[model samples]
Target: MNNQHKPLQNGLHVVVVGAGIGGLACAIACRRANPPLPVTVVERAPEILTIGAGIHIPPNACRVVSSLGLLDKLKQAGGYQVKGFTLRRYQNGNVLVEKPMGMRMKTEYGAEWLAIHRGDYQGVLLEAAREAGADILTNAEVIGIAEGIGESFGKHMVVLKDGKSLVADVVVGADGLWSGVRELVLGRSFPPVETGDLAYRGTFTREHLKSFKNERIDQLMEAENVQVWLGPGRHAVFYPLRNKTEYNLVLLVGDDLPEGVRTSQGSLEEMAANFEGWDPILNTIISCLKSALKWKLLHFKELDQWTKGVIALLGDASHPTLPYQGQGAAMAVEDGAILALLLSRLQNQGISDVPDQRNQQLSDLLLLYQDLRKRRTEVNVAGAVDTRHYYHLSDGDEQICRDKELASLPDSAWQGPCSFNWGDAEYQKSLLGFDGLADAERTFDEWSRKKSRQANI
Candidate 1:
């Protein structure tokens, strides 16, 4: 298995479990490869439906979306181009930091920042995957995975709850946070850890906001920007969607929810109580919320490995993170893109006649995928954790220092003692301007050369 050799089309079949953002992106990326690989995505739900409320797709992810030719579709689906973010004081609604994102993002990162409804984003990816020749099987709940099975020498078996099974050359566990495939890969369950925080999320249309009859609320409904208010043990984020026709809001608060109770019907009174004494604008937004669902915020522990034999995990299955930095979906999108690049490279290295060699080649490729993705994903996970602390700081000298640093504005290029930097453009670029596909290709080349030298020695 070398870069110089091209793998013959031995009819490799890839089965991806789960049809969320990560799973759908993986299927699309694989099928769109130069010499496209056969892909089938199995989703447990009776029908594909969006579970979350909204998602912020920063430039890092926007680049991938553009490369896949779905940016236009995303925009057409009511994706709002975010101008920038405004961080305001919780008590007074005074601006602390104004980080411009629209033109600045494109000029520096080569892609626009987009705020979109989660369902619309998923629909775009699903449509693209199907158009790229990937088969999608709905209501096909994968109950378990069995490796080293099948008469045609299949490497893995995906057992379904419906008593049907699918055998494939590779099994992708994109099933998300409570992934059964991940448990199978690790030989035990490692549930995500609770972060002592819960979020109430909802979306509101412009017409709905107009009912409030408040001028400030009306302005927010018309503006194309993301707004954040930080308070002790709490924070709120709201942004427009679908050409400013709608707005999405997320309210995070310290909670005492019992273990294993993740989702419940959230009460407006409870949500408002958490923001007591806060700016009136946030209250208005809260008033406009027609409905909301509250869920505990949980994070996954870094895994020792993301792949076992011929099975691999992606997205939330591998590294589920808090939404503090808004990079959870971005990381998953990058994972799928890079994984596809590596697999496509493997396809170019013609298959071996010996079964052992073929298996070893596939294993090596999986290892490379893990090696390329592990460090970045871990950094993002840690960054999100750091953001959680910074965003929830109580009133004190530390909070004062954070506000001072933020007050320095877009002109100051300095890093303070705070855990997160809200105004630094360079820091933002490091996270937002990353090119995952390019990085993967570069790393693969380096890895191949190193192995080549070792073989000669």
Candidate 2:
């Protein structure tokens, strides 16, 4: 326990477990609510480390970040406005798909697409959460949480590893893939299942590009556009970061990591071998790699419920998705944005309204949040799966047909099923043109009106 600080005991005290992007987003959003909800973010890490390589903030997530007031900060933190990306043939670097993003996307989706260093992004979010008056307790591991039980009933008891207890009106589990809160919610241990794929990800400084260059590399680096290579059994994505001073690369390939070993050091030799005979610029980028980490892609099956009493799952705790769509973090932040928005509406009512009224309202909102988000996230997850199929298609008739479809697909957003997974008009619109927060706001209002009519209160 951090005895240096005291917790606020009042209506709708939010306990956000984990201080990652989702947790911090939720903490800041709740703190900035109309009446301001008290939020305590409990992080098990002793300190916030400037970790991670790169992250994609699509227009949909950028809107949520704007709501959190960190968009400018992100821009100032060396955010790269991705002009768009080009999908290429792995062996010959043949252009397979090209579409405009960045400012053009702003015109289409109402927000700019950003590529940023994941560490810098997290740092900005953490700083914003702290400035918003969120109580952050680091090195505080949650061993157990009991909701709607004992005197803490309605309120929840969050037992820390250090034998301290936190009583909160609601517990938001923003914890990551291996979530302790999720296990408690399920009343059993449920770990994320591996997806038979591993990600080899790392970064490099532009100065290290001494070994490789070509027309393709020059054009891509000059335009500062995201570049993707789709090949047999794997795919790779590259984008500039930190004002193009650096580059981030992510390669997804079949998992060969020893069984039960989820993460380990990745050899540059293996990385090179994996994509041998591909684009020279990509291979050169790999040549400059200093170190890399291999991570197993994992996801959880849909749960029976994302909320139980005063406890609600957020981010990876509820729906862990594959990285196929680069929406893992995006989905987490979207979850935080909408969940906090709904929880924030329960403001002054918590103090004056009867306990029953407040609890029922909270319950309904959480369930509503689960109801709304589950469907959308599942779609996003399935989209990632669908993308993997197209991205890793082995060269043959199917691959040729996919490339053909990609070349023929319309550029503008359209209705109906997507034509090709890459730059598919409808899929891109669904992924980038969504405003989940706004949708939640409208739906929540309807819910409130419906409740009023039924109770006649």
Candidate 3:
């Protein structure tokens, strides 16, 4: 066993389970912190496979990615800069709301919204993490985690499926919704609940779409915009990718797929059946979709604690939510950025004279990370649930009200007495303009001063 009393800059090791987006981002951030900490990321998959479809990189998330010097690489990997989003009625494809996303979002939030393939995004983060000095080990699945001995020794043992054990000063669980580390931290199993939502995702090249010979489809293919068709109990979002060479489409509906099954082969006929009476343009897109993967959406109840001792959780492992708001990955990225900031602050404090003080400092740092992230993530999780309900409102007075609010877009131009505004100024400010690293630093500064004053007393 490694000596527990070694200084953080010298011997502190961060073992991150799961080499997904959150885990890779955490590894990169930790290694890039001042004094440069050692980080090792383990993945259960034998090899890194390009999993999932497209992802929306909102302005808030883009800022973090850019800070990591990955914006150019991300773009090179066929990431499309989202210019705007058009919300339309699922019945006839009538535009209800149009919101600008490119220069407008950049001018307002200091970052541009990007839409990219999930594989490209993860690859960028993974590569950047590797370059930042994080050791990545694939096919190393963790089975159990046990607390280290002594209060002053902030160490934990991570046991892998291969019967190998690794000890680290801290352990981070970013293993997605079905996180084994979460079960260990909580001392019981906490399975994710099916949200009764299923999504059919697919990506097709422009050449394949051109064979359809539909003018509406051709026009849609040419347009550089993220389009969403909303209706009762369902919605579909489509966007272009790879400099308009390919497009990604996602359809979400209420379903009763078996629990624990992430995805299955879905036929185009079944996908079309879900939106039987929707717009003809939608039908055109659906018909062109070759083979789609339908996955059951799952949600985790807001965890009461994301950290216990030196072990902590990040991303879906800590707070998994519906995709209604399109902030799941963004929230996970924010968690990684904030966690890095907190851990860096501890490194800045230098090794304490007393071993007990050093241990307390490490514990306090993890607590601060939880404090800075938990409330924001909880609120966002609830917001995702609320958005899901709002987007799928049945044809009623509430739906009518929602349509009116959506119609009043360009929020600045609307002078009517609408109680709700889609993408309103307040919402934009809170969601787009949030700087997680800055927020974490401010909170940590306040906390450190408070602790110093208490110590003097």
lDDT assessment of candidate 2: 0.82
- Please report how far candidate 2 places residue 14 from its true position, in Å: 0.1
Clashes of each: 8, 0, 0
Task: State each model's CA lDDT, in order.
Answer: 0.82, 0.82, 0.82
RMSD vs true structure, all candidates: 4.2, 2.4, 2.8
lDDT of 1 by residue, 266-357 (tens): 77788788898999989878887766567899887799999987788999999999898888998899888888878887777566656677
TM-score of each model, in listed order: 0.94, 0.94, 0.93
- Deviation (Å) of 192 in candidate 2: 0.8
Write model 3 residue lDDT over 255-312, tens digit each, in one string. 7567677788877788889999999889888876777678899887888888877788
Task: For candidate 3, give the lDDT.
Answer: 0.82
Worst 10 residues of 3 by lDDT: 413-422
Pairs with steric clashes in candidate 1: 6-348, 6-349, 6-350, 7-348, 7-349, 7-350, 7-351, 78-242
Task: Give the alpha carbon lDDT tens digit for every residue of 1-457 in model 2.
Answer: 3422234755478899999988888888898888788889999989879799999888888989998788899999988688877888999778886776768878878788898999999999999999999989989999987554444555667888888878777889999999988888889899888888998888888766533556666566666777889999998888889987888888889998887788999787887799899987778766766676789888878788888777899889888888877788899999998888888765643433555656667777789889889998888888888888888989899988888777765443423354565555667777888999889989888887887799795
lDDT of 2 at 309: 74
- Give the better candidate number (1 or 3) by TM-score: 1
